[model samples]
Target: MKDVVDRIRESPKLPNPYHIGEICVLLPKDNPDLRGKAGYWGVVSHVGDYSCTVQTWDGDYTVKIEHLKLLELLDEDCQFMQQLCVRLRQLHQVASRDSSVDWLLQGLGKQAKPYLSSLQAKLLAAVEREYKLVWKQPKQN
Candidate 1:
């Protein structure tokens, strides 16, 4: 049992869904509950010990380890990418569709992630500053 657990943990095929856009395939041979999903692809939302949390068109599932296969690794921070896409689309509405900004944002998906993450933080701070956002303090337990 120890050796089996060790091997599972050490397996390079195990999906580590640290960021958004990490993809996985379902291997449902050993699990009847996932039989309908065999060969289907899912996006990893979170990772767990025995199972990973994956999102599909239908919904998210807590899938067992043996039922998962790593498909694609994340190239950048997904949340930042999603937010940037939304903001860029809004900017596109104000500017021309073929504007330089739209072209630049499209290429950011392959850029180094740490810089994008820092940019995301700064953008959020700017929004808060411009809007003067504040909330009441929460009560302590």
Candidate 2:
């Protein structure tokens, strides 16, 4: 039994199969730090031998390749997700600094659906406006 356990521990890890720009869902069962982020999707920003940096709505997280499940989406859908990621990141930053509004922002961050309904999007915008969380568009050069 001891020898078997040792052999298992010594076994080589599998190569990472994911690539940058790919979308993947987080599998947090094995990672305590990601406990509340299970099923959350993100874009792969960087890939290493065993782990990759995933840019989610809330933040960037470096997780093992085994902890991700790839999402097969159309190019347009991926573009939409990338835009949503930026919006969520801005919202998360605002919520982190304001304790009173953190609950609402956190709830939005927890949404697992890839698409938000029109009504939901409008409501989110309203909340952003009410809380002065809107992000200004950068001027083109």
- Highest lDDT: give the candidate number: 2
Q: lDDT per model, in order?
A: 0.52, 0.76
lDDT of 2: 0.76
Per-residue lDDT tens digits of candidate 2, residues 1-141?
999999988999777898888788899977997888887888889999989999987789999888998888776676666667777677677644556445655655556456788876886677678668765544545
Model number with the top TM-score: 2
What is the Cα-based lDDT of residue 21 in candidate 2?
81
Off by over 4 Å in 2: 1-15, 95-112, 131-141
**Candidate 1: pairs in clash:** none
Q: Where does model 1 exceed 4 Å of error?
A: 1-20, 73-141
- Candidate 1 positional error at 78, Å: 8.1
Weakest 10 consecutive residues, lDDT, candidate 1? 105-114
**Model 1 alpha-carbon miss at residue 30, Å:** 2.1
Per-model TM-score, in order, reads 0.39, 0.72
